[model samples]
Target: MEVRRRDPCQSVQNFSSSSAPYHTIFVFLIPLLVGVIEINNVQNRSKSLIETHLMSMCLFLLAILIYAFAYFAAMKSELQVFKAIEMISGSLCSVSLVSIILPRPYGHFSFIIWAFVLLLVAYKESFHMKIWQFWNRFGGNNQQLLPTKCVVGCPAYP
Candidate 1:
């Protein structure tokens, strides 16, 4: 059966109202907070090593955050988490690529790694997803590989 799509606004409203995976949220956000805080020190006598480390950590944290949000949002909402992962992966890949292409930086590898993680998240979500073919376009019947064929050959072939 074809599922009706819910309004985006309503979906977000419902997600926020429900309880999500708190531990998952905390794990990523805390690192992000710390990394952003560390970046603040760059204002005075900024060193390349410090900048590079902070940038890499922040990029990793942001990637983790994206995956966490999708994973948790799925816990409360009826929305397909795979779709969210796919969208996020595509976005992350683009961002990572742009960062690598323009203005060479020491943290180029870090951005690329984020893109890789996004891909892994997408793959994991897809593999775990139980696609209800019966409730989907499959009409709840056994999926046919090719149109029905005779054991040997069809009458028309003979």
Candidate 2:
């Protein structure tokens, strides 16, 4: 008997089934990894600060773009919800990028802006409400931590 290959959709299903845990880990790790890579690139003298930063920004943006497309293709039915998350995350990333791209006075605030962007990135990809809930625990319903429409397609929402 010949062995058969597993269906690709099955793998996608498995990956999407418990995306929160992975998203939580990835959200915390990607920025650290990007920082490390940027430091190493600078130390190696492989690229100037501007070059490395631009490269890093492009890579991060590409990652977001790829994930959005793949997620849409995989889920195939949550277009509206995905669009909302995309808008939120994309806007945050754009603001952070702008802060860094502009001249000194504004660039000085890049780190703070980028930090928020990273958090929003995590929220968009993971839809991990626990992170949001953790921050909002002092008051308000955790149920309302994110807009209902923003989480409509999220596995964690239900």
How much lDDT does candidate 2 score?
0.51
For model 2, state the Cα shift of residue 57 in Å. Answer: 2.1
TM-score, cand. 2: 0.28
> Please, what are the lDDT tens digits per residue for candidate 2 over residues 1-158?
99986554454444433233434444565565556555555646855655646644664577567556644543554344554454444444444444434565765476566677667765675555664455446433333533334344555434
Model 1 RMSD to the real structure?
Answer: 16.4
Candidate 1 structure quality by residue, lDDT tens digits, 1-158: 99976544455444433322333334445555455544654575556433645554454447556755765665566675543663463345344433433355633765666668667855775642333322234432222432344343544333
- Looking at model 2, the pairs that clash are none
Give the per-residue Cα lDDT of candidate 2 at 93: 44
How many steric overlaps are in each model, in order? 1, 0
TM-score of 1: 0.31
Residue 38 local lDDT, model 2: 53
Runs with alpha carbons beyond 4 Å of true place in candidate 2:
1-56, 63-75, 79-84, 114-158
RMSD values, in order shown: 16.4, 14.3
Superposed by TM-score, candidate 2 places the C-alpha of residue 105 at a distance from the truth, in angstroms, of 6.4
